[model samples]
Target: MFIRTENPQTFIKFYPVTVAILVLQIAIWTIYLLPLPSVQMWSNLMTGFNLGIAKGEWWRFLTPIFIHASFSHLLFNSFSLFLFAPALERMLGKVRFFLIYIGSGLVGNIGTYLIMPLEYMHVGSSGAIFGLFGVYVYMVLFRTDLIDRANSQILLTILVISLLMTLINQQVNMIAHIFGLFGGLAFAPLLLNKKSDGF
Candidate 1:
């Protein structure tokens, strides 16, 4: 529910929105790729839902999206963004795309903080990535003609596979993924341009 197509001129002007996020991620990784003296790189600066929240670090909720656990983690999520985010920007306008991206990820973090084991620390953009998938699925269901039917089906399959794989991987934060999906469903109302029932 996060985006509506805008004028081509606006799209061109805002195209850098997605690029800016990518650049920030890359820049952070570039400087903090290796572990430091006490911080273990910049992770202490960036964490998902963790005991840090209890410590009164409220920023913990949204900060983890930028603190990826490993190169592969960042790589896959970044590639996914590269594939999905650009189209979303074009469709929903850059501002709305950002709303969906960050908002869904925040929901995932909140879910992890309240529901998951406090000892486990999560770090990655997978939650946000799943949120993007949720939006795409919603589009396929209600706005089928707005996107390619076949591609939508393919993306859905990919989502399922990713979920199943995560189930097998103990390191992945399944709680965050699930919450992010719910976030997408909840956010659908804002994505729509019409006055009709958002569902």
Candidate 2:
């Protein structure tokens, strides 16, 4: 059975929003990495939000993903966002995709805060990227026709590789990735299948 879906509106769609946010993140990080005082100060501003929830600064949940440790980190995340975000935006539409990204990232940060000590600050878009991965996996499993077997296998392989990379890179917040994956998996099936009669 075909999982009839609408084509995303190319001109007024979620891709632009995702691209804009990622670009802003990259720009902020790039400036922070520079030697300028203004950029440096703005960069350090994130430190105030690092353990925000524990400190009663709840806004940190949203701010953490915008902060990155280094240029290479920001570059890799921006590339991943550029690559995977459009597909998600096209499939889920702008609002849903935005919800998934932000929700998953916030959940990830909360999980990190709960498990890891406050001294070890965590930040990055990896959690949200992993959420995209979880959504892809869910689509492959329950909405099998949405993605073919070959594509599913490829995505799964990539997910495994990404997990391994996170493991090897000790600084990465592996717990956040795990939490985001579970959060996306829990939400994707519910959101994607709402219109269908099948249970």
Candidate 3:
């Protein structure tokens, strides 16, 4: 179910929300990478800095979801979003899917704000992507009817590997990952209720 088979010519026709998000992420990353003083300053201002948030730069929480530290960072998150998000977008429809994605990212950022040190700085969509996994986790555990066995197993394997990587990687913001997961899970019941029949 996670595998994407959408035709390139019509991908945006079917999944406009997912395509829009991908475009936004890439555009933001491009702006960040450009060798321009104004854009560099904007990128710095958008990073998830605990001190900045604490000082009332509240938009930091939302902007960081589209910011990435490097090409690999953008590629990994963007690829993950591309591969997995369309299913949820199609299942949940555009508005609910957008809410879950952004909500989970917000939860991750707010959790980071509360837990991390003032000097801590982070930029990526890992938290939001993990939130998508959390929705899949909810399906595997409680909404089995919404997911088949093979997909469940595959998601479980990925989840385990992701958790292992998160634990092993010293540079990862483990707090955001954990919180983003729970955030997706927390949003699942409300957003997913009565929708299984539709899917």
Local accuracy of candidate 1 as per-residue lDDT tens digits, 27-92: 777767556665553567577647879888889898888777778888988887776777676677
Candidate 3, residues 1-199, lDDT tens digits: the string is: 7777878767898788889989998998877777999998998899999999989999999999988888888898888899888889888888989999999999999999999999999989889989999999999889988888888899999999999999999988899999999999999988985656422
- Cα displacement (Å) at residue 117, model 2: 0.6
lDDT of 1 at 73: 80
Which candidate has the top score in TM-score?
A: 3
In model 1, what is the error at residue 67, expressed in angstroms? Answer: 1.1
What C-alpha lDDT values do all the predictions have?
0.76, 0.74, 0.89
Residue 27 local lDDT, model 2:
77
Can you tell me which runs of candidate 3 are displaced by over 4 Å? 197-199
Model 2 misplaced stretches (Cα beyond 4 Å): 1-14, 34-38, 47-51, 193-199
Best candidate, lDDT: 3
TM-score of structure candidate 1: 0.84
With a 3 Å backbone cut-off (N, CA, C), the pairs that clash in candidate 3 are none
Model 3 residue 7 distance off true place after TM-score fit, in angstroms: 1.0
TM-score of 3: 0.96
